[model samples]
Target: MTQEFGSQSTTDEVLAGVNLHGKRVLVTGTSAGLGVETARALAAHSAHVLGTARDLAKARQATSSVLEAAKAGGGSFELAELDLASLASVRACADRLLAAGEGFDMVIANAGVMAAPFGHTQDGFETQFGTNHLGHFTFINRIAPLLSAGGRLVNLSSAGHRFADVDLDDPNFAQTPYDPWVAYGRSKTANILFAVEFDRRHRDRGVRATAVHPGGIRTELSRHMSQADEEALISTINATNAAAGLPPFTYKSIPQGAATSVWAAVVADGDAVGGHYCEDCHVAAVQDGEGLRGGVRPYALDAERAKALWVLSERLVGEQF
Candidate 1:
């Protein structure tokens, strides 16, 4: 029987009775929070996991549990240095993987920053935009040849994307005022759009790409936010939920946050999620709204916009996919 999963499903629960003895998966941001949990769960299921982090030292210490799980479950776990804020680092990491030549069944772009202060990446693009979107864009495209024919690419996006759409004209916010939330939203939207176009480009080769919202989880992604900032965001969301006669907003557990990613990568039918946006372990409806209840925005999945963003991204990164 096909199992039913929901907002609170844990990684172990999602993988119940499913054996992944030889599947190879690449997950970014294994240093903490959802990334660590994601790697651990996959490793627990005997999936060979290649995890990346900006700081190998910190990721090694944080993912000691992943190593243990891998050992116990007859899987393997390895880590590599990847600083998404630096295109140099991203290319170097991709080059190393390409040189290794082992194919991956899935590439989970799960690393990201949220609501960070105004700044630029090593490439001079806005911090969130460059790190979250362009970095992965270049990194993943660079390693496209290594994606197994039936492989899937899952980008970790968020409901925070509701805050804004991509400003193709001024992605760097040179003339306009900068709001951390807006910048994050643009980056998250880019993640979904990137997945959309990527799926279109690679589906003929049996590779698919999709983006997912992991829901609200108290993870290191929120490190940039102050207590007041977090509380205020919660208050705003809860107020909207209350007005809509919905349950008060609550944060998902780290495992819950990681579940949808694994579900999209391995369990969900590839055709169902390809070029789509998901949340709560299912393909979310395209809903236009002010509240973060649980649906994708129309703009986030626009094909034309996805194509436009893809072109823009290539130009910015000085590479062609």
Candidate 2:
């Protein structure tokens, strides 16, 4: 079964017949783009959605857009605070949710920063690794109890994982030269490793985890890259497309890009199979080429590496689950 969808599928299409009237869902980075769309779609299906943003004000603004969409489709939404760069913020957000004692049926670790300038987060870790991986790691650890039985986790990774593997020796770039793209690549790979380990450790507890590469889409994720870098990437993509006898287009719309993440998180069929990397709404076939479409790299899917990262993450966040 080829469950792969194209760049034209909307959230509603991806979720056409699915319903979650009483299920609680949490979406991070809901201020815009794919995150906002995911939240809107879930809310439209009557799933209680808590969309997290760095600030409540911005989150509300984002929620308003989802609310408008939900009004037409029939559902509701709420806002929460989550600053992936700050462990304290992650703790606070988890605490707030836990205080409500509202168990969530799903958690989408969706908020992420892309190829930004070299910098350290409040935790003294590379910004991409810190926010995209560590933040979600800490949040999941803190909210382990809140994940209702049979809950699922969606870690949004990227095709960029092909560029590099998790640099356990220098995750923070503490002693190495920092290349923003490399850092982003490693972080994306970490996202997959996270799911691999999360599933390994938590499947027995009735929680499963997955990682997905929602195909390339135009979004704020590339904001930090210079025009030249983007052009170079586009050029590379175009060259590859041309070689494959395809068009020059390399990006998809927000809704199209969000389809796979939505599929992995909410699809009833997905519950039986977790810890796999997905693309276009289905478990990705392990690829082999090094130039373009490749399988999850050995390191990215390594159980040992995933476990090591999990241990390191627990130490950093002072939380264990």
Candidate 3:
């Protein structure tokens, strides 16, 4: 039976009565913000959570609260080093997990960078695209076999996917000028597409993938934005809503923002939600328009595009399954 949850739901509230004992889950970016809360909540429910960060020392310090939460709930917490911006680091992390030969019940691709200044990853892909999409793409695929039967993959996408679809011809913007938000939107779109295609290829293997828009929350993901950037973002949001005849934007608290992810990862029925994008703790509608008010863009869920991206990503990462 499918349960109905909403935007106001908290992580604990949504996961209430769900016993995750003996379940092993992997969560990225658990040093702070949504990732930390996500790990905390799952661990609180007696799941063994392996959380990742770029720097192990910093992650240990930053995730002290997660440790406390896990202790309180009699759950296990372990930290791993993972830097999505570096392919070598991604491989190293995957190697460790693969060597362990243990499988995870769920893997949450929750780490990502937001609108940042133009830069390239160590491998020379655009920062946002590289770190957000390609990085996770490579990491997840490499570790995919480690996902146990009936496992779930929850990708953390964003509502910003409405900003722009990916430019397959020029993902790195070699010719086109770089617009931070546009790049972010494209990466987010890729996130959704990754889930769509991943589910298609792996669902028969009992692995299901879904993308999630965790809602707007004040978190470190926006640390790259300045005061002016925030105002401009708000202005763009209000303008978009006005065009859509929708209500003004309202930000969600951290717990509220994480509701949908937790829902997708643990509470929701995997088969029903797989390959779909979710927000407000529910499946988001596919709305093709010039507004970021709500819902996902149709292009983000296009199966053909997802397949095309999967091919392109394999070529770019120089690996295939």
Candidate 4:
């Protein structure tokens, strides 16, 4: 591990002396942004990378550089089709991987949607909850058998989780008014809780799971936001920072954004990261109340809350792990 790694670190810098020649990693949403950079970094370290995306063609095109880098580094890169919003697609993808009998050393659930207009997934849950949390929930649990012992699961959560905690009673906003930020917050919190529960369930087999915040990065995940909305959000964030005597808000580049994911997955100690939330290449502290500068909220890492959500998720998905 790089003792100096922090918010400004890039994926390559964190992995400078690391070798992954025989490792196999599964990274979702490799069609763009941090996913692409993450896959490239791992592959460059000679790790076999199996990346998934909602659109196969798009993924292939986006990952061309990754493939070239892998070849040069004596690694490999491949793509699989996966639509997180569709249970059928998730199941099919898992089934195919199982049938192929290939095992993975790590799974990075990087695909997710950001703030968007109110909507539902094909499975009838709110869009953000479905695609960001539930979809990965069903998919990862189904493919649990494929993860080798000592393997890791890295769920890409967000600092936005501070916006709100999970609303178990109204996850779909059924009786509650829908707000994009709130919905996003709920799903991101679920991401952390999922990791906490999963780590508990699988640690006996030497498998560990953790959630990470990529910090703020400009990417396709923000496609749903209008320019005006984006400006307003940034202004608000900067204002909040100014009040706290902290520096103004700034976004990390793709490599910098992805550094934490790879760091948590490959560099950080297994025991230290298991069931924890990380940001800026290190485990984040539990923070509560207003203004998301960094750190996770307590509710997201509550063990009891994690267990309850797992039960609720199984009921919603109509299947148990």
Q: How does each model score on lDDT?
A: 0.95, 0.83, 0.92, 0.95
Give one digit per residue, the lDDT tens place, for model 2 in 186-243: 9998999999988887888889999988887888788887889888887887777677
lDDT of 3 by residue, 115-173 (tens): 98999999999999999999999999999999998999999999999889998999999
Listed per candidate, the RMSD to the true structure in angstroms reads 0.8, 2.1, 1.1, 0.9
CA deviation > 4 Å runs, candidate 3: none
Candidate 2: stretches off by over 4 Å? 1-7, 241-249, 271-273, 292-294
Tens-place lDDT per residue, model 1, 12-89, is 999998788999999999999999999999999999999999999999999999999999998999999999999999
Q: Deviation in angstroms for 4 in model 3?
A: 2.2
Please say which candidate is ahead in TM-score: 1 or 3.
1
Q: Write the per-residue lDDT of candidate 4 for residues 196-222, one digit (tens) a residue.
A: 999999999999999999999999999
Q: What is the model-wide C-alpha lDDT for candidate 4? A: 0.95
TM-score of each: 0.99, 0.93, 0.98, 0.98
Residue 223, model 1, lDDT: 95
Displacement of the residue 145 alpha carbon in candidate 1, Å: 0.6
